[model samples]
Target: MRITWIALLCLSLVGCGSEGGKTGAAAEAQPEQTFSWKLVTTWPKNFPGLGLAPEHFAENVARMSNGRLKIKVFGAGQLVPAFEVFDAVSQGTAEMGHGAAYYWQGKIPASAFFTAVPFGLNAQEMNAWLHYGGGLELWRELYEPFNLVPYAGGNTGVQMAGWFNREINSMADIKGLKMRIPGLGGEVFTRAGGMSVQRSGGEIYTSMQTGEIDAAEWVGPYNDLAFGFHQIAKYYYYPGWQEPGPTLELIINKQALESLPDDLQAIVESAARAANQNMLDEYTARNNAALIELVETHGVQVKKLPDDVLAELQRISTMVVDEMAAENPLAKRITDSMRVFAKQSKAYHGISEEAYYKARGQE
Candidate 1:
């Protein structure tokens, strides 16, 4: 009887051990969640600089996350229209978007401050303000209401004035002119007696060719050459007072971002920083070569804006910016921050970058 009882006890313990082993195995077998995202951009597919920045960003994220997070980038018109990028990302149709913040000025009046201002910060100064001078914090606050997060994606340093069918020899020449421009610069143009029409980057070439616009300003020589603007317009003007250094943006859906793991979030931010710097470097090198090609091979006439015209435009730009600042409390806050930064930046640049350039030209 005792031997039989001992055997039963041993079998019972064995059965309990088997059950516990099964439960532990099941717990260990739970699968990890992976994320797949769609990023829509405002640039054409594989276009240099602007388009490539987002492409690089997507690649960086994928590589850093080791396939745990994969992002597929779509150019403008692929998943959504260029102008609809902001809305698409906000509504979760896309997890992310790439474009200029000024494009959303109609939705948020303070947004233009994040992109560029008339006679505002250059690329170097702009980057400093954004990264170190509290500009990024302000930008985040402005975008918070839209269910989106903003990051500096790229910068087109000191854009060209524009290609014009008619020469703007004097301030009076601007009157009744129809031009493709946007942001606070567009407002300044309108106040100066020109009609400022909004057109997407892809639409400008056709619009200018078809006589829908008499003048248009894209980025600079590198991008403008790709569109063959020189063929349609006779005079290429310089000193893009409108957009000295316009910063493009990477806007991510807030909910989507919060879903990312902490490590993946850091990867995304670091990648954006890399993409941003890469674009400016690419533009600097490519623009110089493209400018030479435009002047030599294309026989493009590059002219500086007349002093009187520039002076008048500058005056008008001041008025337009001040009026905009007065209209919105947020605008005032942004404008105040920008002005303070610009003043400090200009003072240093005057003696350093500006002076050096002047001396070099004389040599």
Candidate 2:
């Protein structure tokens, strides 16, 4: 009986030991935990800086979080169409989206201030406004209704004006000019006597090639090269006045964001900030080389929009902005906020940036 009792005790202990081992192993294998998320983009798969930045962001988040957070990136049309990215994330179809903020201006006109504006602050100045000038707080508040937590993900810097079939020499040249443009730029263009078609990156090249569009503007040199705009259009214009400092944003579903623990939230935010900087750095580095090739090697004819056209567009931009402010309360508030910050920023930049460039030119 004693021996049997001893044997039973040993058996019970062995079973308990096995159970404990399994539990311990489970705990060890599981990490503080691992989570998977889906990120959809407005660009094609791995489509250079714009597309690849999000993928790199996901990887950085995963690696930095030590496998606690895993994000899978889907390009345009993978989970939803490009324009649908923001809506999909808001509706919980996707947890995250990558795209320019202005794309959603139809839903929120104020959102345009976050992306870019005609003759607005450039990339460096935009970053300053967001980080220092209460811009981020307003941006977050604007997106609150849509249940999106916004983050500055990337900036394409100043884009090229566009590729045109015909040169624009004067204000009259802009009349009836149909261009594939979007967001506030399109509205501004319409006010300037041009028609704007809002189309995705995938559709723009074809639209231009088929003469459906007189001109089309995408991101500057690198992306323009990839899209083969040079092959179809001979006249390339410079100084992307429409999108001086177009900023790409990451839209995270509010519910999804709320579900993340504090640490994970920090990870996401940190990763976004890092990616934002990385994108700007990459674009600055790559654009120089690409511009050189576009001019020297590719025989791309680079030109500036006529002085008359710039003057007319600027005047129209002011009018359209005032009209937008008058019609949409939200647009007014955002525009007012942007105008306040931009005024101060522009003044400072004039004393600093504009002056430096002028002096350098004289040299």
Candidate 3:
């Protein structure tokens, strides 16, 4: 009886060990956990430049993660209205959002720094400031209270002033003029004696066609061309003063981001950086072609904004941004950082980029 019992016990132990080994192997090979996220945007679905950037970002994340993660994108009015993007992401209605930060200035006045400052950093300088000059830290700090995190997603370089139906010959011309402008630039326009109308890209064409707005400033050549602003307005102006280098943002819900795995978190961040540079590259390459097409094929009159008008607008921009900064201590910190970085960048570019450009343009 003892011998029989010993053999039976050995058999039982072997069976148990085999099962345990199989379970261990199965656990090691378990399917990688997958995550799905939704992203909402302020631009039209897959529209060029601004609209396409987020799509590009989503694609990169998917490819980099190798099916471990996926993101779905909803354009303006698809998942939510354009203006609601910030709120949707903040409240966790969406996992991610793509838009300019200045759009939410009503909620946090200091939000404008992450987007653009009137006469502030240009595309290159803005990137340097955000990624290298400690601007991103301030940006993240400003957004923390709202339960959101921000990333620099895209840039429009130096945009054109805008499309105008009438000539801005002087400050007299600006008086009583209605223009579709937003953020600090809009405030500057309003203070310059013009009525600034807040309207999205979809609304601008109709407003201009119906004579509701005398002028409108969309993005520069690439986006302006895509919107076909040339069809609605006669004069296309250069040097977008309101948004010298507007940085589109990728705002993510802090909770949703934290829920991602460590590797996924790294993937999301790396993809954003790549997508950000991809957009600037696209604009730098495609904008000139679009501008040529507008001027040559569409008979659009491409003109430089008058020097005096630009100067006056700059003066107002300085004052308006300063006052805005002073209104909040946080904004003061944000603007102080921007001012310091801009000064340092300007000092270097004055000798390098600016000098090169001047030499290239000489008679």
**Number of the top candidate by TM-score?**
3
lDDT of 3 by residue, 1-363 (tens): 357976778576745446555445666686889999999999989898888899989998999999788999999999999999999999999999999998998888888878888888999999999999999999999999999999999887888889998887788888998999988888899999999898888889999999999999999888898888888899988788888888999999999999999999999999999988988899999999999899889999988878998899899999988898889888898899899999999999999999999999995
- lDDT comparing candidate 2 with the true structure: 0.88
Give lDDT for model 3: 0.90
Q: Once superposed on the true structure, which residue ranges of model 2 sit more than 4 Å away at CA?
A: 1-30
Measured against the true structure, the TM-scores of the candidates, in listed sequence, are 0.91, 0.90, 0.93
All candidates in order of TM-score, best leading? 3, 1, 2
Q: How many angstroms is residue 335 displaced in model 3 relative to the true structure, after the best TM-score fit?
A: 0.7
lDDT scores for all predictions? 0.90, 0.88, 0.90
- Write the residue-wise lDDT of candidate 1 on 1-363 in tens digits: 356976787576735445554445665676657899999998898887888889899998889888888999999999999999999999999999999999998998778878889888889888999999989988998889889999999998999999999988887889999999999889889989999999988899899899999999889999999989999998899998999989999999999999988998999999999989999999998998999999999999999999988898889988888988898787788789889999999899899999999999997
* Weakest lDDT window of 10 consecutive positions for candidate 3: 14-23
Distance (Å) between predicted and true CA of 154, model 3? Answer: 0.5
Clashing pairs for model 2 are none
